[model samples]
Target: MNKALPVILICLLLFQCDSGKDGLPANSQLLRNTDISLSPDSFSPWVPVTNDGFSLGISQETFLSGNRSLFIENQDSLNVNAALWRQTYDGPMPSEGRRLTLRAHLKGENIELKSTGSNIYISVRMFPVEDSEGTTINRFLSSQNRFRIFGTFDWEPLAVSIPSFPKDVEFITVYLVMGPRTTGKVFFDDITLTVE
Candidate 1:
């Protein structure tokens, strides 16, 4: 009976195996709260707390999606100086020379730009974590490999891909940055990161 049990388990494991085109084990998910639900922690992975001296606001409102969508806005005493949000994933870095992709659905209204460098994007940030105690630092920033959104637009799909990264990298962070020094509202839903 024991000998037969081992064979049956092996067969089940083989039948259940699933992976992407890449030789590395597939990691299809990299973001949470994709549906933009009203759950208190829907944006937990993302820090909704305001930063610096800017009045950053994050709320749940019905618009896109079913129940609700993530709403990010900036409202200062005088004007919205800066408001930003992001989803970061930190784990074993991707393999060298592997395709990495980031995708999201976004809609904006009166997306004003207040500064020269202020811009919205779905970008990937790579940090190299040498060891358990090593401070994860930005190793490679995907400058051109990102989806940039601006101005007022309807719900649209945005996607970007990176051919590869260095082997030394040991961690990765995906960013959904709402341009700083900007006013108006931005809606987010269905965000995903995958390596293939």
Candidate 2:
């Protein structure tokens, strides 16, 4: 029966929520096509990366979802270079001091790490919108080494978290790494980045 309460309720009812693309909430992220289910060869956002002896691509032969997953394969046990897939995102940036985390499903076959110094990690790099020389602001990069996977594993989850960024950050880069001393095939799917 309060007059002010009724006016406030009406104002709230008239306000429209921002429904993001694909009918997701404004804060909900579709998070690129990390699943590797989108178009390939010409327009896919995910890019394949490999050393001289490794091969990379979107494979339909193994996947956790959508019948497709990204793969990095090396047959030579002597090869010591890493094979990875990278995606650059210009999605929204988080506030100062907010944490960012990356999560993904990985399947490794015949995985072997020669050194404990290496890890099957997801690396992240956050770049500021602009760099003002002599300022404290700069790009941030990390591959949380504490999280590692090795020696043949089924479909398992992997996560890497990096510290917050300044207000100038505008885009982020992600990498799913396999090895510098491993011979195997690694599949990546359902990758996601969360800002908290």
Candidate 3:
């Protein structure tokens, strides 16, 4: 084998790992503002889900890139099962890939889960259209415990890939979840989605 083969392979690996540094790939043509970088006048595409004691918004205190990151926090005053920031896909359905992947960079402090089922993770809800009317949706997430943060931690990357999306896919809902009455502060940046 050529001496340069190893170096080229390493470069390919690094590029995949740092794909979020500049922005989503050219093929990621489905959603807008996957990263919390844009200052959307109305924040229309990304909806803030304020439920129970959890609240979400953009934060500048810490970010993986750009000037701000999406932030979520659970208030101690209330006990809730879950809260999340959600974005429903509005673009054309992806018809090429058999699987979809979602990823984001996150940092957190004191992420305490009240129940065994509680988890802090990202979820992708898929709506595949079998008829012109609509279709039932299914949700997918990264392995729960592997990426769950219960204590303070530095910036980390988490990813999930789910297979078997039909060619006639309708839409997808992406979620940044703090669940089962999870308490703590988490900031997310460079959230991205891709079909593969």
Candidate 4:
């Protein structure tokens, strides 16, 4: 059936488009580079970059699900304040009273925390998308949640839930950060954020 061939192709294309390029289900909406094994450049848009201190790389020596995992090390040689990698979502915003949860598999090596502020944590910022481009924005209509991760440990489950938002926020940014006075290495895999 030559006529059925086109229908089959169309169905396949639609199915492929429903899921993410890295095989994430349609319900999972927080991460784009869930599995590092998909591609060397699978971590598109999200760069393993930092402002002042830290080193970022991918490693196969340790991982939770895939053949590769993201590894970050604080260079003790530098006066490090924060060493972090972040993923920002400029897409649709969750509605008010929506419950959001962040989860990840993490392992730390000789990790130390800061004495003053949050030493190591997942920082979540929800803000309004700018209506006008290139405008300096400086306000959070909703609360910010910092899921702190501390100490040295094996691959363990780390998760945090946001109760609900009082306002309609449009943009979300998640960061895997080691705050001031934090050092050593941290490995992360299977990081996810879900809205319910």
TM-score of 3: 0.74
In model 2, the runs with Cα more than 4 Å from the true position are 1-27, 40-43, 128-144
- Choose 1 or 4, whichever is better by lDDT: 4
Q: Each model's TM-score? A: 0.66, 0.74, 0.74, 0.69
lDDT of 3 by residue, 122-150 (tens): 87876653434453333444546666567
Candidate no. 2 TM-score: 0.74
Best by TM-score: 2
* C-alpha lDDT values of all predictions: 0.61, 0.70, 0.71, 0.65
- Which stretches in model 3 have alpha-carbon errors above 4 Å? 1-26, 40-42, 128-146
In model 1, the worst 10-residue window by lDDT is 136-145
Query: Which residue pairs does candidate 2 place in steric collision?
Result: none
Q: What is candidate 2's local distance difference test score? A: 0.70
User: Which residue pairs clash within candidate 3?
Assistant: none
TM-score of candidate 4 to 2 decimals: 0.69
Residue 85, model 1: lDDT of: 59
